[model samples]
Target chain A: MSERAKTPLIELHGLTKTYGAGDAAFQALKGIDLTIQQGEFVAIMGPSGSGKSTLMNVLGCLDAPTTGSYRYQGIAVGSLDTDQRSLLRRYALGFVFQGFNLLARTSSLENVELPLLYRGDSRKERHRKAVAALTSVGLATKLDSRPSELSGGQQQRVAIARAIVTEPGTLFADEPTGNLDSVTTRDIMELLTRLNQDRGITVLMVTHDDHVAATARRTVLIKDGLIESDLVRT
Target chain B: MIWNAFSIALREIGRNLTRAFLTVLGIFIGVAAIITMVTLGQGATLAVKAQISNLGNNLLTLRPGTGFGSRAASAGVPSFTQKDAETIGEQISGIAAVAPVRTASQSTIYLDNARACAVTGTTPVYFGINKWRLAEGRFFNDADLRSGAAVCVIGDTVRKELFGGEDPVGARIRIGRASCEVIGLLAAKGQAGMGDQDDTIIMPLSTLRRRLIGKTSSHDINQISISAQDGMDSNALINDITSLMRQRRGLGDNQDDNFNIFDTRQIAETLGATTQLMTMLLAAVAAVSLLVGGIGIMNIMLVSVTERTREIGIRLAIGATAREVLLQFLVEAVTLSGVGGILGIVLAFGLCAGLAHLIQVPFNFNLRINLIAFHFAAAVGVVFGYTPARRAARLDPIDALRHE
Candidate 1:
């Protein structure tokens, strides 16, 4: 088990993504090679029009790289079909959007249970796990409140509960605190950091703020569809 | 997976109930219209059959013309005499009874009350041939016909109009310039396809010709009604009557007979076929509206798919398969139409019962048609829902998530 844990959780070799065809073709990612280990909290930072978002999509298995290979836990993701990739995401991946993306008019508990529903969990099991997830996010009393009724910070907590309820090994957050205030952003960051430390769940986050990136142990920055630098905090 | 999709669909529909109701309005109207039209049409067909059967069993009528609605054929045709009726009864093998008839419209008066009534002149056999029964008094006897007595039997309608509640039997009523004694009252037959059957008065043939019509000619009889024996085929009886009538009229082998014989059973079959054809035509038209309703479902489902693109993105990102997404939308569409079909069935029953009462036809509750309509509505949902569901399922998650 210790040797298996030493192997990289994610590995990409010469990955590239191109949109459209012929003269109108535009390249989003150009020849990127990267590896992420298990239980790593990494931040991806880039300016507008950089390849950071595309890299995040490819790494999350939401989009396939046009040229080259991507392996998640040594399983070749590039060769898998759309449904197979979906299965991979179902068992191993979770996502949090900048908009919270919680279903409107649904209670927070139901929102957290959405991923488990797709996993075919029983009603009792889903309810128990959803309650535990919400409680871990300090939202034990807001179980029945809908997204519209909750504050922005509370909505993000509900989204985080939904992400973790599936017990996925990796969580991809695309600007999860972009819509929240400074104090609420600090609260969400602390919650994410605590999850990484306690549960050993790897987190890949994309952010424009340096202060947000400072919360992670490692940072990778992109410019003009290419990686510019990779830095490690001691 | 399917059960989950169904619950998700139900939740989505419950979120916007007004929109859901409006979306299914077309299907509701279509189903209701189809059921109402078919139910009423079947009721009318049954009513027609009932009324025709009421005319008589195994009855035939011979008139001095090629057929009805042909005045030109009968223009120079000589009318039949009482001897012709006797020949048919004596020669035909399946004969039950035969009666010679002559009729005229005359102004009848009793005291100060006066009204125009059909005055028919025939023997007592005419009542038995037409299946008319007496409500009061007696029919004409052979002695009354032989002596040309001025006695009459009144129908229910004439008794109601001219006699009010008073009994017309044993009373004298003036017919044209002659006074006739009423001896019997015919029972009510209500309304038939031809018209009111209980609005005429009957007298002996000799009395109508000698006293009322003042026509001394014995060959003035215009109609001969013949009834066949029970369980007898009418076509053979008509052929026998035709041969006998031709032999008596002294017609050549190739010459057409100057008269027409009508089998009542054939008339009933023709009338029944016509009504059934009309019913099918109305039902087909109602089915077209049901198709249009399916198109309405497709249109609304397409709109829903487009509006919920972001929701689809979220589900996909959270590990829902494209098949699951497709199933979700498809279930929603079917649920909407299924509910509409049920509501339409309820509405159709109320409307059909009310309309049947107003038009005086029986209300028929046909379960087979209701079930067929409900199943068809659900099928429409599947056929129209596939395109929109496929569209939603095939959406790119990255692009969908960015959609406004």
Candidate 2:
């Protein structure tokens, strides 16, 4: 088969991230090579300390890889300076944490406005976009309810609104339902699936749950520091 | 961006209101203590200067033998007489007037009203030599001085203390076994080291010598005061008095003069230097409290960073520049300090007012210094609030996201 002519969204070659140094140095990621195509929703699965989270960080540009080349849309992301990397993070990446890290004492609408604020959006645009985002996450009715006032499921919905408000190129979710109950987890998964299927949003989510992995069209499993398998099952 | 950071800071402060309040309390107390203590020190310096300047500037006091602290308490000294004062005034070139003083203290009882007070004995020129004003009747004249008249001038304080403000002028007041008519009221002069100059009765030296008490020796004048003319050189006047006194005392060229001439202007430098040193010391002491306040700010910032770890992770993951994170936390710190500083200034002024009334220190209510202190407090907040904010901003998001 001809090599895919379409430019990859993320390309990581010989990627490694180490912690500490000398005899105490522990390698979290060891020579990981991965490619993600445009608009492909993927899932990463691994046991604890398998370096899946490390892989996600490199993918999200939250950190630099220890010794590797990371190309995002043909620009060497791994080589970008702090400000350039910040610029990349500003316009290209969205993040959802497992614990539903919604800012306390803030409205759902304002939570969605955070990423837009980072982009220096005008106030009117910020408000309109935030409202639109809350509508997308089915949080239009809970605009003013604080994080403490919302249930785990509703809080997760608010967090999802926050993530996509910027309309970034990629959405990275790190076990987005780890702290939620099973029913709430299912609801959040369905929401993620809708974003991937209907809106053409590229999503990479990390989860140990097989059910969570099943929602994605492709799943990659890592054991130790290297990827053991990549399965495509639509 | 600064406003946004400030809002976040305000919100964070509100999140844990108790912690914020306690943190600000440290800065507030430090600033307040500094402001109040410095104000007191400034007020004391001003009061002392005013009192000394009001005593007289052109006048010099010559005490017999070596005198250090007070006018009357120099020991082992051969006393000088009023005749010495007369000689100095007549013989010296630049001097305009001379007066010698004698003092006594006793219990005065007049018709069932009794109070203890001091009495001063001086010449008719005593009123002119020092700036003593007559509030009621006339002061002693040349005719009275030459006749050794039994007329006296009593101060407002003496009138209030002894006669209950019943117009002691022209009243006959008894001093020991002698009776003297109060010729004039000396008016209010506030306090002096002469032990409340306003609380004394003034009488002629001749009357005090003849009627109040017999002379124990040929020398009874406790202090001899010389006032230089308005257009005359005070140093030259002093030299003339020194030479004249040396010749009158029969001291040879090698012998050091036993008398000491003190100028009120000389005390200004010594007192001014002392006051400045004391003010700096007070300010330094206050600065220690500011250090404790800074520690308080650091402690609270550390706690805030710890509590907001997950939030920081979310911010970083969502494209916040590290500088932004740093700025937001820095704003929180600065906000605490700024508000604390403002409140501290208010508290300081309040403390000054209360102390001015209670402890009775001089308070001019200096507006410029007050403003400077407020701004300084804000600056302290900035200086002390920077590092912890930077530390919080620099936290790694990947690790922070996993932080419990």
Candidate 3:
């Protein structure tokens, strides 16, 4: 386990992202070099226009870097084609958005089972895993409730269940608690910390609030497309 | 994977039932209209064939002049004689029977009733040629023709009008100035293309010319009906008859024959072709509606893709491939139109049956056309659904997620 922890799960070197072309171009990430180990809970923090979301997008394999290289478990992500990247994300990565992003008019159970559905799991297997995931998030009783019927915090919990339903190695949360009240944010933070410690699932989150950032074991602060400081609590 | 996509599509459609229903309404109307038109067209064609075949099997009527009308019956044209009919009967190889006909509308009085009826002068062979059956009593015998006896066979309508439910057989009725005894009651032949066949009286040609008309010198006849032997081609017989009449009439080369020969089979075929053309035309119009329905589907699918952008983004983020997303939307469109197609088929059946009964045509349920219509509707779904689905699939997850 110590030897496995020594090998980094994600490694980024001189990564940069630019939007648009020619004179219309605006660089979102000037350069980003970061390494994260397995089973770590890290928070990425930045003010508006600091490119933290861009970094999270690149880390989540949703966007490609314009320059430099990113390696997930020593596999060069820049060399992967769109479909290959999709496959990598399908098997190794999961996501939770600030908006919850659960399909509208769908029940909580079906929303939670969506990732497993994409994984091509059988109906019975999807139901079993989704129920287990929802139960872990304290939403077992709200299985048939739609997002409209659920509170914002409950919807976020459903989103979290969906992310972990496929048992992916890493979870990327972009402002997961941004839409929740402070009390519900604490409850969600507790759930994330428990999942990180108990299941050993690596959780990387982006937040502007220092209070939300305090829940993570490590914090990386970005300003003007560059990491200003990365601090470890322990 | 396909099943999963289909279920997802069905669920999405089920979420907004009214919108989905409105979207597919065009498809429903188009399919139903096409099917009803085709079915009715087939029934009309069948009715035409049945009506024409009622005239007689392999029957050909040779009438005076080029065609039927005032111009054809002008004074310059000469009518056929009984000798012409005899010569054709002897000369034509495939001829089964021939009957010379002379018709005149005359007022006949029986008891206290008087009715204007068609007085037909023909022979015993006319009964066989026209497939006429006797409801009661016997037709004129050879002796009756030889003696020029005033005995007639009354059609069903004539019997009912002149006799009023009383059997007219063996009853004497005065036609023109001569009294004739009704020998046979002809069975009802109903309506044919020309008109009602059951409103005439038939007698021997010799009896009508000698006794009723009071003319023994002129042997002019209005028409000659010829029946070909079974399995004989009417076209060949018509060609032969045309040549014979031309030669007998002594027309010079390059002179068009003044007489017209009407073949019942040819009439049936021409009428059938005309009805089929009409069917095709109506079906083509209905097909345009189907095309419009496809366009409607495309329009709605585009809107649906736009409305569900964030949903697509969520699926993409959760590890759905582009192809999977495309399949989901494609299946939704197909399901929408397919359901519409099924509903259209059901509506078409009801409409076809109801209209057929109302219009007095047969209700023809065509399985092949129904199948083709359904497949075409589904195909329309695929064709129209492709663009919107591709648009959904190609969307950038970040941009789509950001969309409100």
Candidate 4:
């Protein structure tokens, strides 16, 4: 195996998360141990309230695990401060939500330029990079269109462009096509697959749909706050 | 980073233009009120000083009164004589001029026009003591005073009311029961003290005592106006006059002088101080509105933060640090108040100018007060904006994202 294949991009050991305390305490994640390799497309599948969203939040560095260790590229993520985690998210991670979170009344070009703005990129560079990213997603002609003016599929495409604008190493999509129709869902999944294969960007998506899970090379099924099955497509 | 924050703030404020304007209105009114009060107050104080200066420098007035406030009510005290004024002018070394004044109110008539005005009887030295100038013809001379000439100098108000556009210098006007020729016109001096100085008529003390009052004796005078020579110590001159008056009145050392001596310059200073105190109080009251304006800003900002919780979450997810979010909201607050400050200044300038013109006072541009008010408004923004900004910065990304 090559060195890139030998090293995992994300490693979670005995990770657990709980909410509230003293009689109202409830465990959302019960000691999950998962690993995702570089340049791999992985899908996390689970039913409603099976802790898949909580796990996705943890992997995206949006939340800290209550117990155990989470490492991104061999560095302990839980030990990092909020600012450091923010930097990590800025440089190494991207997120796409189910609701397609784009700023209202802003052009798609400016929306896509947000991540680059946080990176302290010059305005010209941000514009150039944002255009290139939008073009790669076949949205070069819709740069000036606002999310409210666009369709559901188009808004999601803009969200994806925003996510990948900074060229982070990994993309985390939590039910990215949840709000789309079946035809648009297939289109979005195809785009994710193309990004994974052509750009070699690692993609970790959480979905309950088997059809969405089928697009990934590896699948991990979560039940009762723990991994019940792990499968390889081949 | 500053530019980035500023742009975001600009965009957010622009997006909600109406709400933003309404939110800043409180600051606008507060700043305008403070600046208007202070500027107009300063103008009023300056106007009063200028009018008092028209009474001339190093001037002392001896009135027949022993009480505080107005010296017009001298019923209990004995009036000074013309001899007393002449004695001071001759015996006092630093005396520049001493004019004995005997005042009486009369309705002067000219043709069919009649107006109530003050008729002041004094010598030619009264013009020099008051530094009054003639607008037309010439002032009464010693010949006029000695001969008891029936001549008078009409003020601007009297000239306007009685003569209309016609020149009153060579015309005749009735003073009380005596018909006097208008020999000269006193230049306009506007208003002073409790009445208009330009509305009075000045005449020779001998002419007024004989013709108007029908009094043959020249011993009775209402007051004495004394002017000290240039470079003379006014206090020493006052001391000299006080002792001379006491001796003339035969008052013992233990007895009161039975008279009043006052400085017109000190009166102007006192008026200035009173107006200054009032301006400060008005400004302080207006500053409370600024504090209330700050509270309004805080209230609106808190609502804005809550309304944009999801937006904050989105920003956090896009790698913006909590400090960045904090800075963004703080910049927004400062921008709101800063713009309001500028607008208030413009409004105040217009309002104060209009008010000063209406009240016949000069418009004073006080840059120090304007800048202080502007910066203070901005500071209010920061202080009141802190809590909401901190609340925004401390929000958990997950919970914020989940917010409806």
By TM-score, the best candidate is 4
User: What local lDDT does model 1 show for residue B28?
Assistant: 88
lDDT (tens digit, per residue) of candidate 4 on B128-235: 899899999999999999999999998999999999999998899998999999999999887787588889899998899889987755557988999988888877
**TM-score-superior candidate, 1 or 2:** 1
User: For candidate 2, what is the lDDT?
Assistant: 0.82
Alpha carbon deviation, residue B320, candidate 2 (Å):
2.4
TM-score attained by model 1: 0.91
DockQ top scorer: 4
Query: Model 2 chain A, poorest ten-residue lDDT window?
Result: A1-10
State how far residue B302 of model 3 sits from its true place (Å).
0.7
Candidate 3 ranges beyond 4 A from true positions: A1-4, B69-73, B109-114, B133-190, B250-255
* Stretches of model 4 off by over 4 angstroms after superposition: A1-5, B68-73, B229-236
Q: Cα miss at B127, model 1 (Å)?
A: 3.6
Candidate 1 lDDT over residue span A1-234, tens digit each: 787787799998999999999999999999888899999999999998898999999999999999988999999989987788888888899898899999988999999988888888998999999999999999999999999999999999999999999989999999988999999999999999999999999999999999999999999998888889989899
Which pairs clash in model 2? Answer: none
- Candidate 3 scores a C-alpha RMSD against the true structure in Å of 2.7
By lDDT: ranked, best first: 3, 4, 1, 2
lDDT of each: 0.90, 0.82, 0.91, 0.91
Tell me the lDDT of candidate 1.
0.90
Sorted on DockQ, best first, the list reads 4, 3, 1, 2
What stretches of model 2 exceed 4 Å from their correct place? A1-5, A13-34, A46-50, A105-110, A122-125, A223-234, B1-7, B69-83, B91-93, B104-107, B114-117, B146-149, B209-220, B229-236, B366-387
* Candidate 3: tens digits of C-alpha lDDT, residues B1-404: 89989877887899899989988998999999899999999999998888788788799999878776665654577888899999999999999999999887788999899999889998889999888888999999888988999899999999888999797899999998889999999989777768889999999988988887755444478899999999998889999999999998888899878899988888899999999999989999998999899999999989989999999988888788899999999999999999999999999999999999998878879998899889989999999999999999999888999999
Predicted complex 1: CAPRI docking category: medium
